[model samples]
Target: MNMMGSLVALLVALIWKPDFEEWRLGWDIKLFARIFSGIVISGMAFAVIVWCVDANGPVFVSMFRPVRLVVVVIVASLILQEPIYSGSIIGTVILVGGLYLVLWAKKKEMKSMSNPVETNRTDRNVV
Candidate 1:
């Protein structure tokens, strides 16, 4: 996904060379700064994702992504003075419920994987 985003960003830069002189910043400098910042932040995000996936399984780590929507709502309400509506509350509740279901399923899947089945045919092959 990061790769795709980077590719699209590059395409946009090539197609739309905006005039930065109007904004008091040099085009080359601003372009490089944007690219560099994107790379750095994306790298850090990917690193954290890899670490989380290593420490906790992918399902557990992925369950947290939905919380970003809640954060967005909070930030919008505080920073942009946007009103929180019933739809936002319903969405938050649904997201939380979905995350809970995923977590419960992961626990059940892990438990089933941990227990081995006992077989009666233990006769022929010995290591």
Candidate 2:
């Protein structure tokens, strides 16, 4: 997924080659600074997420990703002074519910793998 995202970004950059020469050095420096900062932040975020998943297990760490959306909404409301709507709360509830279902399924799968006899018995019962 990361590779695909990077590929898409590269394709966009290749298609839209902005003429940096048109901008003054001062403005170009700010643009470069913003871009570099974004790159560094994204890289660090990815690294931390990967390390967390690796150390704590994917299901445990992945659960936090959906919750981050709720945090984002709250922060935006406070920091950016954006209005929070009822629909946003409903959507967030749905997102959390869905994430819980997915994680539950993953846990079940892991449990089944750890108990091969249960899987085999279930397979026999299906037949």
Task: Tell me the lDDT of candidate 2.
Answer: 0.82
Indicate which candidate wins on TM-score: 1
lDDT of 1 by residue, 18-106 (tens): 66554365668888888887799879988999999998778767789999999999899999999999999999999999998988988
List clashing residue pairs in candidate 1.
none
Candidate 1, superposed: residue stretches over 4 Å from native:
2-36, 117-127
Provide TM-scores for the models: 0.65, 0.56
RMSD of each: 5.6, 7.8
Q: Give lDDT tens digits, candidate 2, residues 3-100.
A: 99989987786678656554345656788887887799889988998998888687767677778888899899999999999988998999889888
- Choose the strongest candidate by lDDT: 1
State residue 8's C-alpha deviation in candidate 2, in Å: 11
lDDT of 1: 0.86
Model-by-model lDDT, in order?
0.86, 0.82
